[model samples]
Target: MSHAPVLLAEAMTALALQPGALYVDATFGGGGYSRAMLAAGARVLAFDRDPDAIARGAVLSAEFPDRFQLIESRFSEMDRFVNEPLTGAVFDLGVSSFQFDEGARGFSFQADADLDMRMEKSGPSAAEAVNKLSEAALADLIWGYGEDDASRRIARVLVQERAHHAITRTGQLAELVERAVGGRKGARTHPATKTFQALRMLVNDELGELARGLSAAERALSPEGRLVVVSFHSLEDRLVKNFITERADARGRGSRYAPDLPPERAPSFRLEHKRATAPSDQETAGNPRARSASLRWAVRTDAPAWGELEAPALAPKAEAEWKKLI
Candidate 1:
């Protein structure tokens, strides 16, 4: 009914929290992870780009007082604010339940509302993206971010419909996408789901934030400290997986084709498990949102932090056009 953090126990175990140690909850959505860290007696610093999450966190800040602090900022910028090396850091990536549940936020089409999916409540919204991007860009965004095969069909319809009137409402966009792609008889989800996801990710630059946030955590975590992440989609999971693998030097030396390349960077983090941890059947049944969650964690090593991560240019045409608006 409310926000239940996926993989809470697994993330905590990976953290191996020590009483009085400092921990960072990089995405303090609904204050779930931060609450757990505080309960474990770790001093907590929580960050969220959403103002509502920060307001909700005020209760935890009040209750923990000296033990907890919440900042209303993107997790990517957390290193700038945190001077002390963290004993552990946890990130719960992607949209929070509160955002999806609140129809006014326009993250879902459960209720008709403005097409606005800006996590920070600022910047170019989903409406701007839907109405402004070229057909090719929209198709690319849908395929790249949403992994939807109907992207081209969806984009063609969107362009045709927007000519009569701007696609400015969640319901309006959803209807257009469904009409374009058509419904699958056995599909449980709406045909428009991926289209909406693509628009939302583009609006918020979700992948870009994840890339930067992971690097920030790597830089701020102390040696032996844990870095945990729970991601909801394959795009996010792959990015997290590759980031850790590359940092841990698990990929080995350069390929024979690129033998002239320089040596690999020192392993800054060590992967305790080569594979990601998944939520239990009970957890997935109780909270359908947890079904797609995959948790991967690594322990920081005594090596220097590597250069910052650059978010993959997944949909360059869409991104470039979106940037022009914002």
Candidate 2:
């Protein structure tokens, strides 16, 4: 299936695209957003970690040679590649429909295919972790990445199963998880849904990449430049929300010792809206994937540029609990 850019109009408006403006589409999955930007007369620099995306993007570049440049790299490295400050940036995070539909990619549990869920197809595949990692490590990854409640139990089962045969296929791993977790009757979701998600996150280091990419975008944007991010899951959305809130609040000066913490630096971006915006129900009905999507944005300010800020730690209690599972 062709990957449709979720929230296309909203994302373009969020970036406030203009003619000759340098805009970056950080996740150029299928070029829907990039095409839209090009139509708006923006100069677009787009990146995609997936080789398949890059290959397909070539066609779009051919169509708009001067206006579009497709970079075959992760968005985290965008700062290193771009010379001038960007006018705006957009990141539509999560697995694309193209990835999910391609059985060999191993992004979906429905297919009986190899456990190879690398977004870039260059990293260690899911099979490696399933067949090689220790029980504790596997459990930790599932809990930390997937937020699976029964991670330890599932890990124990995988350990036992892998001893007899390498769980090299998606079906094998999904069945193993289903057996361990006990099939939920009448539930639309599969038992292995979260397990697969966790494995993909760990194998690709998704959250880490996202944290780096967001910071890089902040540094790369020019004054009044917009940063638009559309995230499909809570973990991703939380990071976006916190980053914007902390930066906007930090721009204000106050007593450092007071219970209310002072701004660590001049805020780089002004909050665009008080709350995250979601797609209309009409959009969600047509594109089920858009159902969970949330868009949060901010506009870069004229305030002094600040260095990188430390990313917040995942909950210590959760990390501790996750360690036990691993």
Candidate 3:
């Protein structure tokens, strides 16, 4: 099935696009948002690390040569390509369905392919982690990144098995995880779901990229420019939520009697809504992938851009351990 951009209407609404104004599609997965912006009479500069997205985006660029442009690079580097001030920016976080459905990409275990999940197809793949990382390191990665409680058991079994034969295929790795967890029985998700998520995030350095991207967007936007982010998982959402909250200057005050106060920083943005928005029931039913997605947005203020925000801290216990492996 073709991947549908999640929360399309809400994102467009949040952006509050101005016709002929410049905007950035931070992760142009399949160009859905870019196409919508073009239809709305806005000029869009789209970025994606995946060569596939760039190849596909060529069509839109050709069709709207005067209005649309596509950049083949990670969105975190937005400032390098963003010469003109942007009126708004939109980021659709996480991997695209194109990577999953294509059997060769090995994003999904349904097909037997190399256990490679690199979005750019250039870095170390999933197979390397599965085969090389020590069992304890692997456990820490799964425990910290995936938030899976069964990480130890999974890692132990993976280590024992990989010692005899390398785990190089998606099917092989999935089976190993299932065996470790005693197989799925009517579970809505695959047994290896979280572990795979952790591996993908680590291999891509997605969290680090997201932190830098938020800062880049801050630097690129013009006053009153909008920033919208749609994240599918808790880790992604947490980072984005914190980044926006900090930049929007959501302040907390101490009690009247006695208390602590947050340090004052220039309010770089104003929240578009007090809360995150989720997909409607109808939308979720049509595309299950949208079920976990949330859209949050803010409008840029005239204040100067804050310097790069700090990356979200990882689980302290596993921080040093993970660094040794990856």
Best by lDDT: 1
Which candidate leads the pack in TM-score?
Answer: 1
- Which segments of candidate 1 are over 4 A away from where they belong? 252-263
Worst 10 residues of 1 by lDDT: 254-263
The per-prediction CA RMSD against the true structure, in angstroms, equals: 2.2, 3.7, 1.9
lDDT preference between candidates 1 and 2, better one: 1
Model 1 whole-model lDDT (C-alpha atoms): 0.91
Total backbone collisions for each predicted model: 0, 1, 0
Better by TM-score, candidate 2 or 1: 1
Cα RMSD of predicted structure 3: 1.9
lDDT of 3 by residue, 148-212 (tens): 98999999999999889999999899999999999898899999999888888877878889999
Q: How many pairs of residues collide in model 3?
A: 0
lDDT of 2 by residue, 24-129 (tens): 9999998899999999999999999999999989888899999899999989889888898799999999998999999989999878999999888875678887
Query: Any runs in candidate 2 off by more than 4 Å, and if so which?
Result: 250-262, 309-326
Q: Residue 144 of candidate 2: its Cα lDDT? A: 70
Q: Report the backbone clash tally of model 1.
A: 0
